[model samples]
Target: MTGAWWAAAPAMLVSAAILLVPGLIATAPLRLAWVARIALSSAVSIACIGIAGVAFSLFGVFFAAWQVVLVALVLGVVAWLIRGWVPDAPRERVRWWWLASAWVLSALLIAVVAFWGVASPEQFSQTYDNVFHLGAISHILAGGDASSLTLRTLIEPQRAWAPYPSAWHSLVALNVQLCGVSVPVAVNATWIAVCATVWLPGVAWLAQLIARPFESGRVALIALPLGTAFGAMPYALLSWGTLYPTFLATALVPAAIAIPVAVWPPRFRVRVGRAVLAGAAGLAAVLAAIVFAQPRVLATWAVMMAPFVLYFAWRAYRPAWRAGGRHRRRAVTALVAAVGALVVAAGVGFAYVVFRLGLFERPLDDRLGGPQAKASQSVAAGISQVLGQAWPAGSTGTISFPSIPLALFVIVGIVAVWRGRRLRWALVSYLALAILFVIAAGADDVLTKLLTALWYKDRYRLSSALPVFGVAFAALGILVSARWLGHRAVRRRTGAVAFAWGTALVSALTLVVSGGSSAIAVVFALPAASAADEVVSVRQIQFLQDVGRIVPADERLLGDPWDGSAMSLLFGDREPVFPHVNGQWDPHRLLLAQRLGEIETVPEVCQALDALRVRYVVYNPHEFGGGDPIGNQFFAIHDAVGAGLFEPLLTDGESTLYRIDQCGRLPAR
Candidate 1:
């Protein structure tokens, strides 16, 4: 199984190219700094994929890798044609080796952690959400339709298609088609690429932007290595929900927030006509890419950018009020009115997206009850977790200790940046995020619901967002402390040598303390155990592999999706009558799910079997989640076997493949 990882090389290369090359080409005319370009490429590429997928669906063309590449080329050509309209800004001078070393180190650290987490490339997460994500990729491969607007048809075939973010699935499917890797391998490859390439560099770029006037180079170097130390993000998210789309979107958040600052620098003196237009257009393209990746992240980006926006607005317009005159009062009034109008506009937009569009509208009285009904921490505990950089509660199934080194660094960082006029916004942004986390993790009142419902009021999702800013602060904190110590040393030579050693020691200590915790180790090790058969046992997988030889590819099988039978869609190239474990299934599917075992007695069961063209049943009674009521929907199939209605075609231990001979033959499609 480990040898199969070598096959993932093609998938990794293809995934990286699909994610980076198009954006690199399109943004060439902008002439951004090397780091900035690398940070924004994945966002631009995802945006292009979203646009291409929608256009293809509308034009009745199949979504394919070749067509996506063509779309990117066209956009690049357009960018080149308009190159002369945008003015060049002064570029930061930094040695290429410095940046390369930082990136390589970060990539290596992330790769080691990822490799340790999933011991085999073919293994997949066995969490509930993974079922939909994996099935969505298979659906795309089988049907060649990868549009976000129609991807939900995998589970909701009866309803009119509504948009669900498919950027993650679309990219993985393209890799499978172009690189010939299995779905699991493609998923693992894409995840590693997103982490090493997108998340690591993005946070470093953001650190550079935030730590302005404080030597950007050192901050970036420190941030690159420290970004992976936090277990709250990338790791907790990987284990908790295996929320793949959220993971991608959150990884891009740092870049999305940093691009505006990069494009329109504080001292930008370019002409206000064409240059501004070009910059705005480029920013729009990147923002579109983020929305396509995950719409909820737009809220995350807005929360982080609010402080910057207010600060910038004040800095831009305060001159008029300071030069007091007849216009001074009018200027002040205009500023107030403008601020009020913006507040109103934001309120209206949030309402429209939440209430009108019906997004993130999980009821407070859901099956698992609501956020209010769950076990929660005290407000003090939540704040302490944020300050200490501890893992969110319930993510690791055990109490997590705070990283003392990280907490101290964050404090020093907050104090260090508080005095800088522009750099202080990083602290403010983190404060806002921390408040939101506190509300979700500690309080469960109306305010919590109002502020956090966009994230489904889930603390793990909210906690996952903290490290986006926490990493930047901690990096700044470490560099600031190192410089302070270096300046105060007794001798110049001793100070220099001592500074380097001290910085390396502190970084290593922080990484060891944060990344090597028992809790985080468990999180990384969970995937390997999940793959060991928490859902589908090793015997069940072998049973499916053997049954694949006898089952016709064109025919479908009926079974409880929770019992791991739906996996045949990938392993056996045979679609299940129910593609997922949960959905508002169509009448025929629902009828079969409930009464397929009674095919010998119920006329509707036979009718459903005939209509759905299901001639086989794959029964594995070891249902996931230990036979929860959810799987009971398909319990009637157990009775069907007991009644001798199914003719056994094959058997492997407890798993069996049976032909539905009891149901009369129907005309072939």
Candidate 2:
């Protein structure tokens, strides 16, 4: 197989092993045709990664493509052994071409955005967070650890586990091992897969799950491509902060929603009672997926879906509690559904709380507080920013509001679904989530502090729910509006069906085309870091590589804890003296301000470096001394350079590497 195909082989395997078989078993009872089954399966499959990762950790094994094959085989056997998955009477048949067309269109749209922003040597996001993501991947590849639990030992305090979700990183590492792709290529592949394999298919599944007319699945499918167009999403995330983990986690949201929707719908009963059981399992899997990939995403989704979960519980049990003799089975079923869904939801939440999975023990940096911590945005300004009417230059990520037309559609859908059991869940949940977003952004210190207990006063992250639910609701709105137009015009106009379809198609297409065009233009239009910044970054990586040629891979480096310092750990395979990002491990920022700021004399500077075991000092005049002004305060080396206590090991114009072993100062030993 060609290398590209070789890289794709694992994706195909993952789809089959994790998605295809179980999806067949779970949805078979409903006799949901191909489109629904495939969409739901896509979600279940992503969740399976978390499960597989945990299993491997227990065995202390590295994740590879073949590991999925092993999991698939076991799941297949379990699937074979399970019974009672009786196929129901067939629903209205839909043509396969609609699904294929929608899939292709969604794939093309996702690809356009991904390829347009594709990072390369000359082209890359200039955001600050990219370093942590790129460096984490490199550390995994070089350090030879893929276990999500243990991998944090690379940069975190020794033996102290950091609960930063590593499922995304682990998957990238697996791709590298099995596909023999470079770390960058593997990173790109993970990004593409999250969008194409999970997000697109996931949206389709969610639409079909709740659509009133089953065939609205097709309309929902057609309408969902508009999802990529939202200003705060897929592209906005890339430009704003290069939030790789957030991107991965949010991409999995629709799939996460799909897991529960698959079961406990229509009404609750015992011959097929295991459906609720299956829902519980699927929910568990999705929770596992979220916890492993990005735990905060789980919290975010949980908060967003709080209302939906409550409504789900009420619907599942009310029928059973209210029904009589003839409705006894109905009552039993309803009770079962309610109990199962509620228990699972509560169980997941309980585990997260009890386990303290967020690693909150690590202190939050006082220097760089939460998004709104430094300076409060007035509630009015925050709302304006969230709606994309205006953006504060310093905000962490993109926040979007519905455009006028899109906003109109969303209101229509909300009203249309007011009485709909099938779709009503979306409305309540969205309102609940939106309220949280507003509260988080409120300027009142007391309110922000109260909400901080949820996500550290990070309002923008909560604002992500807008684009996610906004796209789906807007699509549904389009579907409802088209149907209304079709019904009203059937008697009043010629070719009413054709007219509704055409009007809907044109309107939906406009959103997709316009959104896609705007995203492409915006991303490509952003100035790449100045040619000077690029040269500085490229030379810094190259300089580190050259240093690696001479020093051991384990050499401890001391540099400013800014973007300038990324090269030492990312490219040079050396751990920096402090891996500081918003008070991650070290408290007080003492190491950053103290060790790097005041060193002057030979013995004094050497003693400080010895305490931290920092052997080399990197002075990138542009990145540290000159590039990012913050680097100077964090690691001020002007006095050391002036005093000649540091010996210049290498110099490239403005960048220099200094050996600390000068003035007869020997190694600590």
Candidate 3:
């Protein structure tokens, strides 16, 4: 594992370059403040990756490392050519040391937590969603295509092409190709890099924007350390669904929202025409990145920006209402028409997403009613969970304690910002998300589905987004409290040294009560041995790697995906008949899954295996989630060896590899 950690160094460097360099170069023409440029770089880089991937795929070119570099250079050159066209926004001249110190501290804290959580570079979350994410990266490498438009072909071959967010997959695949690391190593290292480089700085930038009228630099410093204090975000998402795409997109939300805030009327002081153009361009790039990374995040972005939109709309209405005489009726009518047009557009967009795009249509599962039942029992508990940043929804038992320190800070922050007109928007945005989370967590009805349909009404998804705004509020609270304490100390004739000690003591107490470090460890801990819930164990992976060496590349293996065999694509570099836990599998694959053991008894079984080119089988009976019901379809395959239809090729105590001799091998490619 130590070697694995050392191996991740180059992978992390490659990830940082892939995630940052292009954006930094391309956005140079915008002439933003250095902090603003750095904060938005990841979004720009992701946009470049996704666009380039689709372009390469369209042209039948390989999407490899050199291609990625070439795309970055091309974007940089285009941006440099337009340098004179886009007007420069005002740059705040904070001391370089202030940003440097804050970034270094934030990066260190985040890296420590991320590294400790991952435990090893090769380690990956064994959760359900990882099946698709890990396989998607491998699919990109295998097919030489990383386009979001065609990524779903891995699971939905019948469609041949479907729109699926693949920006995260593209970045990881590029890292693996450039660094020569395995998929798991690339995934873990890239996540760590994104958190430190993209997420922390992005949030700090948002805090600076929100507190711009006050000591903005000091607020950023206060916010940076607190970025890791929340449990719902980078940590919970990492463990729960292993939602790699959503995690990456959510990291950019703060920066994405900041673009509009910086450019909107009443707040922005720049010349309207040039500033609006620049802001709109930047916002478009970030939104493209968000859509590519995860389309679901667009809803989250819209929710967070709702208050700013209302504020802008209000500003537009004020002058119309105040106009004199004859112009008043015309101005008011124009304003009403504009507002109506916006509402109609929103309605159409919602319909397109729900019906035309066909996303977030999953119905609720009734089996897991305990959590929902408990949550619906008390709305107050749901509110407490959101404010405290306790995540994975319904984690209100003795094992999942609420963060009293965070809740108190958020309450204080709400009170502190209640009077400030601009900063109060943060409260409004936070409250909006908090309400959505409460609805998703505490209700499972028609209204809940209608409101949270974008997120499939999944409480975990809703809860994971709350911390995007919660952390800033908590940091603001701490900043105000510290300033007040220092003022009181000066008034009481206490020295600066006493104030410093008091702040240190209070910070330490807060950290302890928040349980930030301990909570991360608990959530990210991977199983050391094969468990019913865990997908694969250390020994199992070693065995798979060994089997990969002996197996021919041309032949595919048949196995129950729920038994962790789907991971063969990632760990063994060998294709599996089914690469995901669930999908709209074709009839032939379904027949093999249910009746592969009937090969001798049923002629169709042999024909199905032959048609699919599957000459080998992996029998790992330890199904994930303790014999998940999905694995029930493959019970016949599991009993094939005992039925004496499979020839033993290899074994590692519990898992075995068998050759299906009855199904004659297909001709070599």
Candidate 4:
């Protein structure tokens, strides 16, 4: 019950925060849209400044402050260019039905991601780095003293010496403390839930924005559902923290695309405030940085939208030069200010890079790194085969899923384009981008040479483009179905019947190909699945959750970083005992699990685990076979220590936990 309550706190607090921000803006004395936009943009700007400053202060990363300033400046330039683009229009009333549908659909997807999906092996195993760090963090949250925890923990040592950023972990800890819950669970749940809430709103909100230019509820409804579905995947939302800024960075992609399209400029009378487009870009840059701390997301964003950026710049420049009066001067000032801001931001970011990376070097040296030849390689190949063969299999069934309304909408979108609707060009452009990404991502060489330089190496780099494709497909479906029903030659009921019957037929075909009734049932059952409240309570699960909390914040606790990070938010400013990234660290423990019986050398295995100061052995039974000797040896070791080598902490049938004794050992480093 306590665990459940702790989990609920953050959700409730976020809900409250969401209401407060808009309410305060709405009720302001000179309430106007630009006021809200500027305020949010400014707050985001300041936050970035604070984050970079924190990094600099703690790690002596001198150029961190400049990165924040650089991003804000660039956004200012973009806004100045687009300042007058918004045309005067009446205050549009919010469409409740559209909003309701979007929220409902997104909520359903969250449930599926949270409950139905299998846990990830790559991310959720023991003997991975970050495990002990999270365990130590949990201990601190559970009432372990932080001063001792930090001094005694491996994560803290990593924080001081290694280049890992503490922003995400620290932020989660702060939220958990404020919510007054078990820091570990609340922090974990908060990351997962917040990722869904923040990004999904932007995704669905994009539909409304895109349809604004068209002024069609049908278009908005069709597009928003597709966006919601794109983010609903189990892997996307729940895989936070473990994946770090990548998930957060990916979430920002849609928002980067949407702000220019959706956010209406303030009425022309208010010339002092930032333009909506500028504010949007600024916010996107800052948010993108918060996750990955990578400058590339912003650069890609600017590059991708260069045409739009250029158009706005032209609008601002052309009018000012033509007016040749006070207006011309005002335009000149805005242009100068904008350019100045971008220059400043760029300078700051560059300086920070130089300070941390020894004169603007990449984290990893520029080498072929090596091919991904394991299961990851296999998965990449599978993804390639799906694209090459399945794409040409016919657009008819490639995106088909057994949902009636969705099927009809997709069909309509396709037909609407085929009939030479004016919107077809935009749809075509969107599809072109998705197809390009899918194709470019397939070749390991191409992926390594291009995107992996900016981002990490992953075939799933194509995932970002999926949402764009999803919305396009959904739009095509809706347009085609609507046209068929509205044809003048058909009787009204007959036309409606034709649309419904055709939709059903297509849906059935999709179900047949998608593994028959079970897959179909799962798809349809998504919305009906029960949504978990703010907190979920499991009996023994809370042990790991609490143990992570109670360990002194500075105490070094070793465990699998992969699974350890799931609830790591509770740990106060700690690092994972094992470092997972770049594979530069040792992996003897993992090898122990892999080659348990045939290893013939028990002493080496025990010595490695001990040397790592692995105080807690968290064994995920799901990943290890029952007959594995490492599992057997672990039990034997625990028994030898009166099972005192580890205190039996938590157990689900799927996972087991044991707390390791210090054994009179001193902290590493």
The per-residue C-alpha lDDT of model 4 at residue 596 equals 27
* Rank ordering of all candidates by TM-score, starting from the highest: 1, 3, 2, 4
Candidate 3, residue 320: how far the Cα is off, in Å: 3.0
Q: What are the root-mean-square deviations of the candidates from the true structure over C-alphas?
A: 4.0, 6.4, 4.1, 10.7
TM-scores for every candidate against the unseen true structure: 0.88, 0.76, 0.88, 0.55
- Compose the digit string of candidate 4's lDDT tens values, residues 1-669: 123333354444553243123323322222223212322332343334335435344443333223445544554554446546433332324365644554445444443333332221111212222343344344434432322213233333334333333333433444445555454444445444443444444444444444343333344444433543332122322222134334444545555655554443234443425456444544554453333322334533443344444345556777788989988888788677656655675565455445643433553344324321111323344444333212211111122233545434644555555565434434554444444344443444534333333333332333444454345455445445555557652343234334433443443344335432222122112111111210112322344455556554554444433332233333323333442211234455444333322223455654555565545554332211122222332233323333344556665553455654434353565
lDDT per residue as tens, model 3, 1-669:
245586578888789888888888677666666667787888888888988888889988878766655676776776676555455544545577866776665665555644453567666766678888988998898878988888887777667677798899999999888888888888887987888777887887777676565455555656666676666666666655667898989998988988877776533445567667767777888898888899788778877776776666666677766876656776677567757756775686579656864545554433223332324535676776765545442122222446566667767767877866666666787887788778776776656656676776666677667767776677666666666766663432223223322432343344334453344344344566565667888777777787788778876778888887887877787888999878778878888878877787798987777777788888776877666553376677777866878888898887889888886776554
**For model 3, what is the C-alpha lDDT against the true structure?**
0.71
All candidates' lDDT scores?
0.71, 0.54, 0.71, 0.40
The global Cα lDDT (0 to 1) of model 2 is: 0.54
RMSD from true fold, candidate 1? 4.0
Give residue 244's error in model 2 in angstroms.
Answer: 2.1
**What is candidate 2's lDDT per residue for 1-669, written digit by digit as tens?**
123434454543443343345434433334444554565555545445555655676675655555555665555455444434422322424466655665656655554544443334123343456556665666666654555676565456545565456667766666666666556556655665666565666665665555536454454454446554444455545544556777767767876776566664534343445766655655665666666677777766775566676676666556656666657677676557756766786676655543553424443333225444443555666555544322221223333333455556656667767756556667777766666656666644554444444454555456555656666665666666666666653332223223323433443344334343243333323232222332135556677777666555545776655535554665576766644332334422344345444554324655555555665777655432125433445545545555566678887665667776542343544
In model 1, which range of ten residues has the least summed lDDT?
Answer: 524-533
lDDT of 1 by residue, 1-669 (tens): 246566687787788888888788777776666667787777778888888887898777878977777777888887887777666533445567876776766665655544553456767777677878888888878877888888887788787676788889999988888888888889988987788778887887777776665556565666776676666667666666668898888888888777667655434556555665766677677678777777787777777777776666576567867888966886777568658756875786579556764546665334222532353778888888777776652334543557667778778878888876666666788888888877777776666666676776777777777778777777767666666766652343234223333443453344344443333334334331123335575567777778778877777878878878878877777888877887778999988767776666689877887888888888875666556553377767777776778888898657889988777676678
| Runs with alpha carbons beyond 4 Å of true place in candidate 1 | 1-10, 81-92, 115-117, 263-266, 273-275, 321-373, 393-395, 488-533, 627-631
Report the candidate with higher TM-score, 1 versus 4. Answer: 1
Candidate 4: minimum summed lDDT over ten consecutive residues — where?
A: 526-535
